[model samples]
Target: MPVHDPYAWALDFEALGLVPAVGIAYSLALRRYPAERWRIACFAAGLALILAAFVTPLHTLSMHFLLSAHLLQNVVLAEWAPALCVLGLPPALAAAACRRSVVGTLTHPLVALPLWLGTYFAWHVPAAYDAALRHPTSLIHVEHGCYFVAGFLFWWPALQNAPHRLSGGTRALYLFAAFVLAAPLGLLLALIPRAVYDFYVHAPHRIWGLSPLADQQIGGAAMALEQASVLFAASTYFFLRFLGGDERAEAYRSLQRSS
Candidate 1:
């Protein structure tokens, strides 16, 4: 059975447009600065992939009622979408954009921190999930936007690709804390015995005809997998930096001893 309206899927291209628009706007605004084209390309490509996922038959087919299909959708939204968006950040452009008074205030860790947390919580709420299913196109815009912003903020510290550059140790600590904080949420979702979202529970859609509970479990798994990817990548980078710092310190001590 069809999970979504074809018309709704077609209209969803607007969500994809925002990614390039934001990227281009930032690029043009900071054209004078030495920019990273690779990062811009990653950002643009990520948005394009997300738009392709939803606007094509992939989204409808996945929503048709299979745990794996549902999991794929979650991966696209939570993991792949965010990762690509962050990869496109050029430190110079970020610094330029941060010069704007309002942008600086909003991107401040204090503000971005809570917004990230709120976006995570709000989308997972049962009501919100149901609303997203009913109004697929509009909710997609909101969902993808949240993912993009959250990813950008999360990467800010580690990449130092933002207006604010945090010390290596600080970035490491942030990554650690984020991993610890998000673990319980993933566990909670994974442990749920039944479908939490009403739309999935009641909808006639079925991928390979899997049950709604299974689909929900798959969604939880997707969240866990994405978190694991972020934690592993960030931790690896931090560890390498830490080891290099230690080596430098050891070399300095050897020189002092020789002198």
Candidate 2:
């Protein structure tokens, strides 16, 4: 019998390569546009998180051992990493990209919301999920790529300060809708009676003695919790900004009347 090694490191050269490639590209962009220090920091952090996800044992566990680990990886790839990277973009660069007709259209809130939601649920279909795991080299790559791209589009309009950026109030509402819309999948995964993805159920070795159904439930719960926390924070920030703007406008009107 072979001992299971959940903590063993797993490296994905293609994924790891993205860190330096993106860093170099960002550096070049910074030279041209001179982004603020925080923007640079956000980009660096995003790349670092991406590197962590692929280079750490998280990758190994996700690939072969645990549904929860895989779900966690998806959250990082689809939400945290993409959001930070978009936030890190230089204003000039972001504006230029947003001005492009295709980018503008796809990133429009109406279009982006559905695309992201579709990608999120479609990939989670048990058959599709199992196929990706079974063919990790090809289908898995496609799955992760789609998640990242869809996530990038999902966050672009809300976070990017381009000419077509949504107003604070509208952005808040958009995020609220996203939160509401994205919740069902996670809830389903968590509350379902059985394990939906056979990849994890039939995994050669179970980690920490968690049953497939338990692992699935944990993954689903994590997904829902993360989405709720992150989206709520973002939405509240935008909503507050909307309120502050209204207050400022009212103050200006009062000053004009007094004058």
Candidate 3:
């Protein structure tokens, strides 16, 4: 009976509050340390993407109507934004954060990988996802929070200095395993004959006449491709590093030292 305005660009006033909060937090946290401009830019870009996903019409669509939009939000929160935020951390800051005993204990590839996969898959189960959608607004935030944290956990062990150091070859294999194993759920959702979750069936208006199921399928495909692209690029980096031998490895290590 109701149609959403496809051009709707604004809603969720509370979401706008996040940008200044994050900016202030970042400024205060790193105030003592002079951060590189590029790192600051990365962090700013990550924040901007997050704001776009939640503060704009995307939030209205995701929270009230469409699963596809929600999935896109999840991708931004779980992967793109968090990765950039982590990368933006200065090397000393990153090392210090990673060295915390709790971080040390949990961020090992073995622990982090399983934890990430479990959280990711568990949340995608129809009952779980639908519950998040149906419950109090706080539940939605919780769901997104879990996804964000899990993503960071999964990615951190590879990029930062961890307690159990992985060799370049091992890192490559680890990334390959992670990306490959995490992909099938999305692929299945994308190709399934029927909609896997019923939550979005009544989503207000169809975008371009795409049915709810089609939207879900599109979301799944987007998830698969987005992650595949990121993982492929990262895997290449690690694989190339693995092939570079100790001489090249040491040379790069030295550059890191000098920075």
Candidate 4:
């Protein structure tokens, strides 16, 4: 792709401002509650992912070039980055932040899961998706903003130990259910013979020589693969924790009976 004055290869500054804003907040939090090295690393990694998604040419490509690129960007905003950022929070910070009644209620699995799913599916609807792309500067930002916020809420019940934490078994079930519910969207997109979004169908130039249908399929497959990997890994971790807790409980009972 040629580097034109305004094109897919251009850098997007729309989300660039958030980097400094989030950095300042993190810096202040660090001063008050010293985070562990791993936490700091996770937080830094999350920010880096955000930059790669929105600050680089990838963001422009997503907006103009390929459906696969756009789907990959969405995955980062809605899953990978949010999970790491949530994991990066210090214990004290997480507790204090989640302590609010509104926060607790919103982040509860019952509430968060549906909201996240709704946002995911609603935005992917052809009409909405096309509209967002049509008004890239305005509606697209709104679309991405919703994804980011919902992502944080979606991961909170599974990751945080404050205000309201799910049991290991519940967390595993929560994640498993999320995967089951959300997987079909990707499958539908991949399996559909025709391109879902008109914007991509009418794109000025096809960068990778991929037909619209092929590009859509690739994007859909990527979405499914990412969700399966990230969600399944988290679910397995919690499920193992559940099993370990059960085994420990049984051991304690055995010791009590022996005494």
lDDT of 4 by residue, 1-259 (tens): 4443224355567657787689789989999878999998998888888888886777877887788889999999989888889888898898887768898889888999999999999999999999998897799989998988899899988988787757889999999999999999998999999997999898887776899999999999989988899898889999998988974686689999999
Candidate 2 lDDT (Cα, 0 to 1): 0.89
Clashes of 4: 0
Query: How would you order the candidates by lDDT, starting with the best?
Result: 2, 4, 3, 1
Using alpha carbons, what is the TM-score of model 3?
A: 0.87
Judging by TM-score against the true structure, name the best candidate.
2
| C-alpha TM-scores of all predictions | 0.77, 0.93, 0.87, 0.91
List candidate 2 stretches off by more than 4 Å: 1-4, 246-259
TM-score of 2: 0.93
Q: lDDT (0-100) at residue 128 of candidate 1? A: 76
- What digit string (tens of lDDT, one per residue) describes model 3 on residues 46-157? 8888788877788767766678888888888888887777666666666676668888777788988898889889999989998898773578778887887888777777
Q: Could you tell me how far off, in angstroms, the CA of residue 180 lies in candidate 1 after the best superposition?
A: 1.9
Each candidate: RMSD to true structure?
Answer: 4.9, 3.2, 3.0, 3.7
State the local distance difference test value for candidate 1: 0.65
* Model 3 pairs in collision: none
For residues 82-125, write the lDDT of model 2, one tens digit per residue: 99998899999988776788988988889998999999999999
How does model 1 score by TM-score?
Answer: 0.77
